[model samples]
Target: MSRKEDGTLVLNKTKIFDTENCYIYQRGGTESKYWQFYYWDSEGREGFRIRKSLRTKDFLIAQSLAQREYINIRAKIQNEESLQTLTVAEMTNIFLAKKKLDISSVPHAGITPETYRILKNRCEKLNNFLGKDTRVDHLKRSAFKEYEQWRKDGYGGKVPKTKTTIKTELSTFKSIIQDIAIKDKRVISNAPDIPKITIPPSEDEHRRNHFRHEELRVLIGTINEWKEEKTLRKTAGLHRQMIACAIELMLNSGIRVGAVRKIRWRDIRVNPKDNPKQQKIFRIITIPSENNKTGKQYECNCEIALIVEHLKRISRFNSPSDLLFCNQNDGKTFSSRIWADCWNEIIKRSGLEEESGRRFSYYSLRHTYATVSLANKVPLQLLASNMDTGTKYIQDHYYHHETEELTEELNPIKRTRKMTADEMLAQYLPQKI
Candidate 1:
């Protein structure tokens, strides 16, 4: 217990008047309430106070009420500080920007510009659906379900987006929010409770289709004819070569279009060990860590050395450092849109567009390669390695064959077991022989 110079009782330099803490002092020889609660806070080196009123005679009640109010105010301040005041749109931007940076640093993150574009478009749609003022904290589990139903009902145009597309979009959103929440400590915890968007059953039985040998021949001939006729305006010859190389490379090596685009001239190494006279030749194409989607380097055996030779022939005319397949106009790399346009044009000219509702693009070449390789009895592991993808994916998506090599290996022993039905029945049924 302590007291001030005015003889008022003080507890730790805080004057206690009638069981209430207050600051009392003498001015002009008259004792008066400062009308504030004052105290030398914990460290006791300095003093602080909250004022109630200058003329208040009841110091005790005023101090007690002031302390209670102080506590409540402090709590309100803390609550406000703890909350993050960002809108959903702002958070999404920050999240995606960080993601872009992360993906850029990775050797092969598989998150391409096209992927970003698609994600951005989907996020825009989500933003529009949820409304601009919607807060991140306000996003409920039911909102995602609603979004799914809305997409299913065709929010924009055409049929509702497929379940796979919806799933991907939702996954992107979830990843963004989760990442932001984890990085920013002040943010409210709302991510874990959000439900993942469910994927609907696929209507299409086949995820991919492979071109037949005849179809491939027809496509090649049509593309060649288009090039010869100079029907394409911007890149007649280059597009022709690109499509041809893309087809041949896929048919031979089974590499994806993205991987094909990333291939440099130096990545290819021809086999010098093989005898030149016997025509036994092979080429090795190294998919660098940066070019591969899985971030794993793959050494693929180039089955069609002639295709590599043709690429090499084209490389001689262009800059050695330039991309293998470059745009004809400025000798730069072809953009994704340009690539798509070229494929669309080829499909239109080939007349295969009417037969198959879905036109075969560069990716179709990859699918064709996988299917053809599986048909040729390529080992699953080997196919996986060549494609620079996982073995499980290869088996799941491409391989449909049911034959077992183990049965063939065990056939010789089975051939000798020619027991008749009576002998087999006797062996099963009889104990007395």
Candidate 2:
């Protein structure tokens, strides 16, 4: 037996080739008749041994297999490729496991549980589309070209998915490949190119379902009536008040429904000034990273201090740590079913849905806020920051063509002919009353 400087033990056992560091040998015992390929890799500071079964008893066949693998490994090392031989399924699993760890290790910068579920679903779709056994390194750019159509057709089902839904799913799929190949360095090759989905413009579609001012007034009126209804149980009344608070916060602050559901009393901060109006006018609301979809903590100015005061006056769970909108009996967040039922009832009673011919959800309040703010000429950058989104998104989704209300601004009188002196004087100067 001989030992190398790199700590590689050279056994004076069976050797098929005259290679110093790499060789093929067979171990004695009922370890079977299979030959083994052994290589001592000394590429890095710490050397390691690589061993694999050639799965053949014949010396020539084992020699051929060993040589081929050795050459391939050397070429990979030369190209600086990853040594991991992961399939699509294996890569997806690894990505998910890392994501799960990220949730605990870096909650502020990690994906939320809801986002995890969504990513898992997208990964399943990717696995189904491209066979799970497909090697990550072998993936080609052309493989994703038809994915949009395949996903849209609902995998040959009856109901086709919308382009918007397909676009989001494709984004998640692309992110998965990028995360594994580029970010994690798990693939031998660079990340494969994914085709982008071009979603057709759906201008004013978001605002169409949003509550108009008249509709909002009607909704508030319905809420006032429903919350104070005499037939409601004590716990039920508490729930309604919390729902009202949630609606007002979303309407005034443009906060997402999901983030609103997770708000705690301590998450809100009021101005320290003695002025009551100033305190109510300038409240800061913090959306925790775990509560929001983006997984990034941010604070936005909101005038919901008065509403918070009202909730504090009536809420059973008013402790700083308790959720502001929790169930009075158990201090738990309201279930999805409870929220949906209340919102549907509110819509049914408001009668705005019948008049407007559009359905409204909790998210409609946030949309309403954006639409109204844009109409009031709020700057795109300011509104985007308030909503924790991008200016381009606000411009694209909230820009409505219905500028009839702004006729004075959108289409001022254009003088094709010379204006009369009296007309010019009247337009330019204010007349004495």
Candidate 3:
């Protein structure tokens, strides 16, 4: 309908072209033979674009050809059978941008960063190895096994990557290409299966990441000491206390650090239904589906009921909408900063850093809650549900081999009185001779 500056005038922009971006446009003048069907096609090696060709001399014929080509493109997209013509680098950028948009678009998702930095790094490594090229289309599904070996053995001058690391990268890679291919009308269904990689028994086998009861007690005592020493009218002291609260909360409730950071004062209350007499603070922390990773509402009971009550009394933000652990300055959730500050200080001051064989972070609190609960005879399925994970994962990854706990359940052997040495010798010798 309109002529583009220094470009061809579009004959018409109709519904047929909107979804797939395929339409008719004349290059120079509106000569009928100059009419072209600008449609997406994988006929040539240039990996996917508005593939143009002079279809007919008549405008009406051009429209018919364009529509037919668009139909074929749509069919290819729906069937996921179209050849992907995008370079690996282009797909990587699109995928990362999409991931950023997903997090930002969702409110109260609890993830603070827009960048998936780790995944980005992996993608970059993939780009470096694959050369950011259209040759990515030549990646044969049959060659996936060879590619896996090349990844493991450091072939083609690429750095050797671990199975877990490579698996994550390949998953991202698969997701990216499939999405772009479908969107670009290159493919229609799910991407072909990438070869599976095995996770070694020792891969991330830090099963001792949980704290023992005595150690947890020591850590709590240290936190209390920290509160006493660090307590001041200044904002710094309050944040430290908040961090300590977060640790205690995670230790008891098995809530993730991400969910803990998004807690609001409005979400907490004493449920009278649970406490009919209203004599006790039957406190509850409501995790909304938006804030939780599982997208399920989880009501976490107060791990330390007294501490929860105390926080309620002394909270700087008492309003319903106020964040429970806000940054003292901005009045926003302090989850992003909690790890870099108070958690580090707690580990150092408690001497846990030097003693723990494995590195422990805020997540260890969740692990500890599960471990302690399991050791004390809590049901495995119940613990898994509480942890928002599977029973198999609990058995394989988080559960500690606390042999001492098992000893208590076994029947004790009765002790026989020791026979005198002469009586033992006579009994043995009579039989031996």
Candidate 2 lDDT over 13-125, as tens digits, reads 44434667788766643447677788866664345467888899898888889888888878877887655567889878988988877664234576666577767777888
| Candidate 3: segments with Cα more than 4 A from true spot | 1-88, 104-118, 124-163, 181-198, 204-209, 214-233, 271-282, 335-359, 377-401, 411-433
| Candidate 3: 10-residue stretch with minimal lDDT | 105-114
lDDT of 1 at 327: 67
Residue-wise C-alpha lDDT for candidate 1, range 1-433, written one tens digit per residue = 5555766554323344333433442233245534545532221222223333434546565556556655654574466432235577777677667656654624555467777777677668767776756777666656665666677787733444356666666777677667774455335455634446555444344656567667788888877776566554645675667767866777678887878877777777766765674234567788877777777778887676777677667543345466677766666677877778778887788888577655467777887788778777788888887788778887667655535534764676757668778988988885975
Global lDDT for candidate 3?
A: 0.69
Candidate 2 residue runs with Cα over 4 Å from true position: 1-16, 24-36, 39-50, 53-85, 104-108, 133-142, 156-161, 178-196, 203-210, 214-244, 256-259, 268-306, 309-315, 327-364, 373-402, 407-433
Which sequence of candidate numbers ranks them by TM-score, best first? 1, 2, 3
**Residue pairs with backbone atoms closer than 3 Å in model 3 (clashes):** 77-188, 80-187, 80-188, 80-189, 82-186
Tens-digit per-residue lDDT, 1-433, candidate 3: 7675556566554445565446676655545546666554444344466556755667777777777878877786666555445667877787777777655424455333634655677677667656787444555665355556666677544554346767777787677667775454354334556877888775656464777777788788998998767454678777777777778878878888878888888887776667454426446788887777777877765445666766666567768898877777788877454666677787788887677544568888888988888877889987776667889888877788877766645534444557768988887675744
- Comparison by lDDT, 1 against 3, better one: 3
Worst 10 residues of 1 by lDDT: 39-48
